[model samples]
Target chain A: MKKNRLGEFQELVLMTVIVLQDDAYGVEIQRDLEERLKKRLSVGAIQTALKRMVEKGFLTSEFGEATQKRGGKRKRIYSATPYAHQVLREMRDLRAQLWDAMPRLGTSQA
Target chain B: MKKNRLGEFQELVLMTVIVLQDDAYGVEIQRDLEERLKKRLSVGAIQTALKRMVEKGFLTSEFGEATQKRGGKRKRIYSATPYAHQVLREMRDLRAQLWDAMPRLGTSQA
Candidate 1:
């Protein structure tokens, strides 16, 4: 099978989904990313990216039970698929390979 | 300048544009990417991505002189800017650092 490539934002978003665990949803994912990356993100953009990821099979989403607090609007929770996890591992490994080839990264600047 | 993040496809396209150098036009870029990646890409998608990259300042485009080969349609040539080059370097360095942190990557797996 061919490997799917993740965009920079896609990878970060995927990692965030993992970090958020079962609580991953549009609003929560956006909030978590904002907090961690210290970057401003629009809800619509996050939703669009999330939808795209889902279509690409990197993520799976399901509607959570509606809560009275939000007037019965269910949240669409997201999680990384097994494929996503494998892709992340591969990316990490590829990055690892490139890093190991460089000896002066963490050393003194000379 | 704020560090801009690259998407997987965006990075691949940027790298292809860089590889194509002065000959980097839409058709050549599309063809080059298809040849190197062994994937089919639409002209519209490539053009859209290229336009987006230009908007993000990761790429710059200029109209090349219309050649008789293309029936007088000037090709839009793309090139990575200094900012793009810096981002690529940073990404490479980041990958390198991550790789070096993995001690067992290149070692015998037991």
Candidate 2:
């Protein structure tokens, strides 16, 4: 559980990062997740999760080239590592298996 | 999100309950999850999760008839409510959307 666990929020954040791609940064990730999850996410919460994920080898980040758009500040762009992709796939497959194993609703069997 | 949110563990537990049907009790749920997830889970953790889910209206439980098989002790059996099924379906759909939206691996469009 400790080695390869992805929390619900962490999974959602990682998905948002993968979907955002080149524009995967703090503000953009927060916005995308908020829009998709329909929840008001605190920037602090997203940033913390991003930091933890980067440390966990699930994601990698690099500073973009400095631009004059905001006084030459470089944005930290995030990307999902191959490891993250594998874990995500495993989760999806496991979930699918569980769903398939479920009996039809209203059919109770011990 | 607060109104209809399912944590990853909660979702998994709920799915297991549906799959295990009438046999969805504390010990069985824990064993099934540990086997499928390949992680050691504490009895306390599983029980706490079940309690929370019940409070959240995602599950319902009942005490099974006392049996001599377990020294006349009744097991508390859990079942997923309609709301749980709906939330699980929504989560599956949402994950599929994210997976689809992702760019093909190694073909970095960014």
Tell me, by TM-score, which candidate is best. Answer: 2
* Cand 1, B chain, TM: 0.86
How far is A46's C-alpha from truth in model 2 (Å)?
Answer: 1.2
- Across A19-103, the per-residue lDDT of candidate 2 in tens digits comes to 8889999988999888877779999999999999988899999998876785757889999999999999899899989988998
DockQ value of candidate 2:
0.77
lDDT of each candidate versus the true structure: 0.75, 0.87
Model 1, A65: alpha-carbon shift in Å?
11
Which ten residues in a row are the worst by lDDT in model 1 chain A?
A: A97-106
Q: A-chain TM-score per prediction?
A: 0.86, 0.86
The estimated TM-scores of all candidates read 0.56, 0.88
Docking quality (DockQ) for each candidate:
0.12, 0.77
lDDT of 1 at A76: 91
For residues A10-85, write the lDDT of model 1, one tens digit per residue.
7777777776777889898899778755678999978888888898899999988888884768999998888887
